[model samples]
Target: MTDRPERDALRPRLSGGLTVEVIETSALGDRSYVASDGEVAVVVDPQRDIDRVLAAAGRLGGRIGLVLETHVHNDYVSGGLELSRLTGADYGVSAKDDPPFPHRALDDGDIIDVSPRLRIRAVATPGHTFHHLSYVLEGSEGPVGVFTGGSLLYGTTGRTDLLGEHHSEELARHQHTSVRKLGDLLPDGAHIWPTHGFGSFCSASPAEGDASTIGEQKSANPAFTLAEHEFVEQTLAGLDAYPAYYAHMGVRNIAGPEPLDLRAPTHADPEELRRRLDGGEWVVDLRSRKAFVKSHLAGTVSLGLDGPMVTWLGWMIDWGAPLTLLGETADEVAEAQRELARIGIDRLAAAATGTPDELAADRAQLTSIPVATFTDLAAAFDSGGSGGGGGSATDGELPAPDVVLDVRTRSEFGDSHVRSAVHVPLYEVTQRAGEVPHGTVWVHCGSGYRAAAAASLLARAGRDVVLIDDSFDNAAEAGVPLES
Candidate 1:
């Protein structure tokens, strides 16, 4: 039972002349890595933070010799290609089936000799994705461990509900075949490392324990215990609603991926940014509401500049439509560009020109407003304030036909809720808001962070919104009736 905190330390062990590293990608999609050899390292499927991987390789004083992806990830953007270009590593993915993207495809029997003792064998495993593969590290002692990717988890395996147009029947069949193959090929004692854990939507039962043995997984994994038909039913049952943005990636990957140049986007200019926006480009400002409210280009939407940029943006932005950036600074603009690249969002026409004011000379092209602080928001809610700059609702008043939008997780919402409140989690608010009756909107989360996101999303979409501003603890303490 290797704990996650220990595995995340990026300590590489010596096997023959090779050094191996294991890094963990946190809930927000940030990753850290390990480097073993002085000039050679292997990078696993990187989350959005490429700097962490690069910094790890730089500290080891070795170039990244190989880039590996265990599967086609759905929960977060895969930064495999970006790190490969940055570290000069050869990218590797399974060659058994044609992947959505191009790479130095490897087969089931393929082996890469990074060093004398460190050879990685690509094992074709097809449950999570038809092309998903796991890499087994053959050390002198025996097979040390395998980067199982989404095929297997700490307690569960990856779900097959993500196969949009692809036949779920065929995909489920492949998944069943894949895990059985993995169970046979991998030694019972072999170490198992997977990408997701608790809080991930990809697996309902992501293990709290980080790495487990193949023997342990066989004993514990629910998917492995079922027959093919039963396994398919179990895998598809009760999957959370996938973000709307996921339906487009398969086609994008089938086309060869174009490398992104971090220097500056070619299409970024004042007129071009406007043209793209006029052309229906979705302007995503990767800055805080404070920064955004201080000044932002007209017709821009704010989603902030961190974690799951690709995942959330993919959910929000249309792929063929153009995009523009409102970053913190010039450096952040570059970070945003790289973040978009992982999801194949390459249609950037230009960046925000000069300053918000300089670009707003036309006046129609600019909009700025005062942002309410959380404290102020809380106060307004206490006094039954409507917060639309209109007037306050009287004490004990529900803003006539007011709809309380619970932005907490479904499980959290199921646990309890305000009276007559509609439940649409922050994740699904963007897609499901059409169902919200045109009336006052009051949003709340376990805390206020997610509620703020929900409110802002509704506000940008031209909905009248307010914040409940209740902490989970306080909401319960106030003796509010919980549904369950």
Candidate 2:
């Protein structure tokens, strides 16, 4: 579910005496909560940005008293350690992880009092991870809401694939039981607050709505409606590929993540950029995919600023490698940096704001790639076409590519794709690019966003590339030969 909150306020208030202020990180489309009862504030699943969580608590007339994490997160870094150090709050991490940082190892059934009238009781909901915990915010009357991190979501549960591919089926069955347990324990009237439903790729199934209640889910959620075996099968089939960075988050979180530092992005001249690029360093361009495909600096890669920039950046770029960013403005660079910080990518070699003229001062260095409609390439292939130089043979200037590189995910490619298309997912293209025979390579995604990125990478590797800048929905209508 996509939440449309005001510029500063949290959305969909949970019904209770507790003041629940949501700090939804819209860049990653994930939610964190600040719940206070006039005196003590309890923060849940905070991102690396801790100032906003503190500010939200202050606005509600309370100081932060506790930091809580429901599990070892697989999406982004948890700010619990940093937030706890700065605020002197007791940090709650699941006991099973045995986190290295100073924290209270929160266990199932443990109750932490927030105020005279408010308490948070932890419930063992081990579906998201092996030791996941869900907290039920309790008032004088009873339960108010359950902060179900990734265990039990509005319509589904967290993906079990994160643990290991081998454990997925086992975990899926466990998730079903855990979800049912939450519905059994929490009151029907209690509200459901999940941290992953927005755009976080943690859920096993799609998040159905903005919010739902324990009673509502009990009546409608798969845990209640479908047979346990059917629910497991449906969930396993529904799981999609998560970002590659997810593989490292659990280990990083256990080691203890560093607090975010907006390492000042310094200005670098064209010469410095050239030296870095020549030395095999990365220059990530933060522009619209459209702008990038139209014009970009030679040897630079495109992972546009507006989409899932951080996820791709973290996935594709080597953690130890020196990286620089190029954006049209300082604000654009900073915006990309902020999102990167959530995943604990706190530093960059440098950040520069550049213009086309500066990049193209040396005429041969001016880079521009064209978009291909699916049909144009289809017809070329219909007449025994493989790509010539990654560009159109139809366009006389470049060599034709031998491969039609479809940069969409494996799952997307599996459902439906052109019969001639080769699958090299956008993130893994860097390592796998050498496998493609020398020719013009056609690259595309469901949308054109990642197509620009894929083409840029292949071009940087000296492969002739074309960006298929059309929607995938047009494939069948365009008379392309498709295979499932």
- Tell me how candidate 2 scores on lDDT: 0.81
TM-score of 2: 0.91
lDDT of 1 by residue, 282-320 (tens): 767777545554566655665665434455566655557
Clash count, candidate 2: 18
| Tens-place lDDT digits, model 2, residues 1-484 | 1223534334444445677888877657578998887788899999887877888888878889889999989889888899999999999988888976799988889999878767999988887788989999987777888899988787777888899888888888888898888888988888888898776778776688876889999878887788889988988888878887887788889899987888668778877887787787899989888888777778888888777778787888887678888988888888788788788777788888867567544656678886778777776675566643333465554335467888887778999987767888988889999887766777778888888888898989998787888899998898877889
Give residue 164's lDDT in candidate 1 (0 to 100).
59
The candidate scoring highest on TM-score is 2
Worst 10 residues of 1 by lDDT: 1-10
- lDDT minimum window of 10 residues, candidate 2: 1-10
Quality of model 1 by C-alpha lDDT: 0.63
